[model samples]
Target: MEFFTIKPCKTQAAYVVEPKKPLHLDLKALKVPFDITARTPVLMAMRIDGVDVSLYPSGKMLIQCDEPECIAKKVWGEVA
Candidate 1:
C-alpha cells in the first residue's frame, strides 16, 4: 500500500486520484488512525483486485478485506 499525495483546502481537504492501472471495481480504503488533523492532506494508493483508483479528498474509497480502524484512512488522498 503506497500513497499518492495529500493536499488541503479551506473548508475541506483536497485529494487527487490517479490509478497506477485502470480500475473499474470495488476498493476498500482503510482510514488508519493518525495524530494529524482531519483537515490535513493525505495521499494514498491502494491495490484492489490488481487495480488502482485515484481517490479525491473527502472522497470515498472501497475497502478490500476489512475496513480500516480509524480516521486516518477515511480522509481522501491524492493519487500520484
Candidate 2:
C-alpha cells in the first residue's frame, strides 16, 4: 500500500510526508529497535539511513537532508 506522499516544503532543502492515516508508533516499543532517544505523544525524532527524521502522530513527517525528494520515498519505504 502507498503509505505516504512526499512534497517539498516552502523552506529550502526540506521535505514533508503526509500519510494516508495517523501513524501507530509506540515509542516505548520502538526505543531500542529504532534507537529513539526522545519522544512525546505528538512527536518522535530519530535517524534513519543517516538522515534525520521527525515524525508526528498525525502522520506527517519532516525530513531534512541534502538528498533529493527521492530520499523521502526511500525513507517511507523503510518505515512503512
Candidate 1 TM-score over all chains jointly: 0.23
Instruction: Go through the candidates in order and give each one's C-alpha lDDT.
Output: 0.34, 0.63
Give Cα distance to truth, residue 21, candidate 2, Å.
2.7
Off by over 4 Å in 2: 24-32, 66-80
* Tens digits of per-residue lDDT for model 1, 1-80: 23333333234333332233443332234353332222223434545343333333444343332222122243333221
Candidate number with greatest TM-score: 2
lDDT of 2: 0.63
lDDT of 2 by residue, 2-27 (tens): 54567778886677877777667654
